[model samples]
Target: MPVHNMHERVLSMGSEEAGALLDSLSAGTADRLWPYDNWPPMEFDRPLSAGAKGGHGPVRYTVAAYVPGVWIRFTFTGPRGFHGFHEYAVLPVDEERTVLRHTLSMRVSGLARLSWPLAYRWMHDALLEDSLDLAERPARQARWSPYVRLLRALVTRVH
Candidate 1:
């Protein structure tokens, strides 16, 4: 089946400011956008740009396209069954506001069809929401669902 998931936030900041946050992705300690404190850190073989390869934890992908602070797309390379890409986009809402969006579009096959719905989907949702929280400072933290909490516990024990 096909899956299209998105999480977005309208922040009281200019597009340039939001774009700066996008540029900070995977920048180690300098990164202020990804919620690495609560989840697996997003890492890449090199600085984020077109063709960069990396992913958080078990997921893997290569940067298929990049446009500085404006947008970036990553095409998946692992987990066996994810067929497609995920991306982040910065959209100017107004002079003082911008919309930051993360989108995951893919088709799952074989085990992923089951794993995605049973485990990955829940974790993905929580992670993206936390990511949005990080993008918008002073925002309320995104809460984890009971299932998500349980799944996280299981993964923690195994790893």
Candidate 2:
């Protein structure tokens, strides 16, 4: 069977930094890249245009979540094999280490999982991992201010 796989990566940066960029994602960003925006804002970032500043390759996606952050969701054809609703919770791996992981099947499973394979190959195996890493690296270092303001605005709007 072509397994519906879950791919995760830990940037050298901690969840704190990752969370910031993760929080920056909004309908604006999703409309530009993937479809849907109800999934929790992820600890990732994707740039709007090819080779844009602080952009990784032709795409840039970032997020900063606080639940204490925002909640967002979506669907897309990309690496990670038709990524479903992914969730993350930050924790210290060591006294000075932290990690964020992607949770698979939080939504859209069963038939969707079985059906995604052929059409979402860009989202599988080696290619999927690298594509996500492309955006993760730069977003780890992405500026915190925009993310800060963005998160605040989102929280205010929701409440």
Candidate 3:
């Protein structure tokens, strides 16, 4: 299966602030950024660091690697067909700003081939964009497309 990727970056307020936001994610305290509040939130079995195991809803993964205030990677372990990882990173843009990036790169197989394109991809995109907005405070509302809204409605209800 080909690797599908979704990458999003936003101008963060500052390196300190962006690093802090990444810290919040590492602590599993950034649930508000997920697209729907009704769904199960992302979490780690232990703190977000190398070797921690966690995931939300049907997706499961282990923390493959991490660098405090810089990057954290989670390697997928579930939904039966996902083969890859997702990560968040903070790149210093300058003294007053940083680029907060979230990326998901995976090789899908079996059911994932269907689910990833038909369902998960759209939701993931919306979720990341919303997360990026939160990373840059005075958060702007995510402009959810009708497709994204529908996916959110269905997934949240089913879960």
Candidate 4:
């Protein structure tokens, strides 16, 4: 099955400021975008750039393309059946507004076709929302669904 999953947040900040958030991805304690506190951290063999290899938890990918403070794309390379890429892009809406978007485009085969819609989809959605919340800095935090909570508990037990 083909999957085109996307999540985006319109932030009330300049493009440069929003771009800075993208640049901070996987930057250890300085990372302000990825929701590492509640989820698996995005790690790579080296600093984030083209050819860096890593992914959160069971997922794995390599940085296929990168444009500092603008856009980055990762091509999947693991867990079998995940074939395609996911990317983050910074789109300026205006001088005072910007759109931070994460897109997952892929085709799932074998067990992934089942695991994806059943489990990974829920967890992925929640994680992306959490990431966006970190970027938006909303006064009220985003809440994960009950299914997501249960899934997290189950995965934690296994790991």
Candidate 5:
């Protein structure tokens, strides 16, 4: 595990559902995740392991992560730096209800662990969780905004 990381139990929707949510969260930084953004999230591509479900089904993956200054390996085994390893476990809370457990883990080496505190700045989980319902369900009625063109400047590349 990395000297710094985050791990928390989040009540998820479903494997496929969560996968979609995961994809969307990732898309926010897709250009970065895929190494096409200004400050790309990682050094290389994050490869999804076979038999591990993801956008298609359950699965495991190893993603190279660059956390600001340090770089690390993330996988089911453990993360090696500031990046936290993640997992998706589907739990049957009920017949129609499933909880997607997304766990993030990081390895601690030396002084870094002593000084850095794990912080969840509304990352991966909360951000997606907020718009999850909106995304999962149908879109609301389209309302016209006169400043639609003006707002585009704020999110220059949202399209």
Candidate 6:
């Protein structure tokens, strides 16, 4: 199994604002940015910190590491085929400019090879773009194409 990675970044934010966005990745606040509002929101058994355990919907993971207002990584634990981590990071480019980056890197096995490309990849891209749009405020929403919408519809049914 080879690693499948997706990276999306949004610009023009302050580090504090970006960091706050990263901090908000927990159970209560994630829906405000991510497309979680339309799906099962990200959640955890405890506070957003290392050792916490949770994930969205049937995709389970653990809080592998976290740094308040900076970064947090989650290592996948379920769906039986994902192996790797996803992380949110805030990078300061200047006093008034920051970048919020989300990265998911994993090597899949078994059904994931087909499912990741045929299904999850599309939804993940749309959802990440929507999330970055939320982070990039004052900017328009990411244009969701009909294909993305169709994929969303299909995945929504599976959940």
| Candidate 4 to truth, TM | 0.97
Number of the top-ranking candidate, with lDDT as the measure: 4
Clashes of 4: 0
Q: Report residue 46 deviation for candidate 6 (angstroms).
A: 1.0
Cα lDDT of candidate 1 equals 0.93
Error of 2 at 101 (Å): 1.8
- The per-prediction CA RMSD against the true structure, in angstroms, equals 0.8, 14.6, 2.1, 0.9, 11.6, 1.9
lDDT of 1 by residue, 1-159 (tens): 999999999988999999999999999888878888888999999989898999999999999999998999999998899999999999999999999999999999989999999999999999989888888868667799899999999999999
User: Candidate 4 residues 16-103, lDDT tens each?
Assistant: 9998999999997799999898999999999999999999999999999999889999999987999999999999999999999999
Off by over 4 Å in 3: 26-39
TM-score of each: 0.98, 0.39, 0.88, 0.97, 0.36, 0.89
Between candidates 3 and 4, which one is better according to lDDT? 4
What are the per-residue Cα lDDT tens digits for candidate 2 across 1-159?
Answer: 333455556556655655554444333453221212322332233442222122112222222223522232233323333334343444446544455444444233455465445332233233334334543645232222444445435645876
Return model 3's CA RMSD, one decimal: 2.1
lDDT string, candidate 6, 1-159, tens digits: 776565666577788988887777754644445656555688889988899999887789999999988888999998789999888888899988887878898999999989888877777777778788777777456677788788878866876
Lowest lDDT block of 10, candidate 2: 49-58
Better of 1 and 2 by TM-score: 1
Query: Which of 4 and 6 is ahead in TM-score?
Result: 4
Two-way lDDT contest, 4 vs 5, winner: 4
Candidate order, TM-score descending: 1, 4, 6, 3, 2, 5
Count of clashes, each model: 0, 29, 0, 0, 13, 0
lDDT of 2: 0.38
* Residue 142 displacement in candidate 3 (angstroms): 2.2
The lowest-lDDT stretch of 10 consecutive residues in candidate 5 is 31-40
Per-residue CA lDDT of model 3 for 1-159, tens digit only, reads 776566656574677777777777634445434434534678778876899998887889999998877888899999899999998888888887777778788899998899999988887777777777766667777788999898878876876
Name the TM-score of candidate 2. Answer: 0.39
Residue 1's lDDT in candidate 4: 96
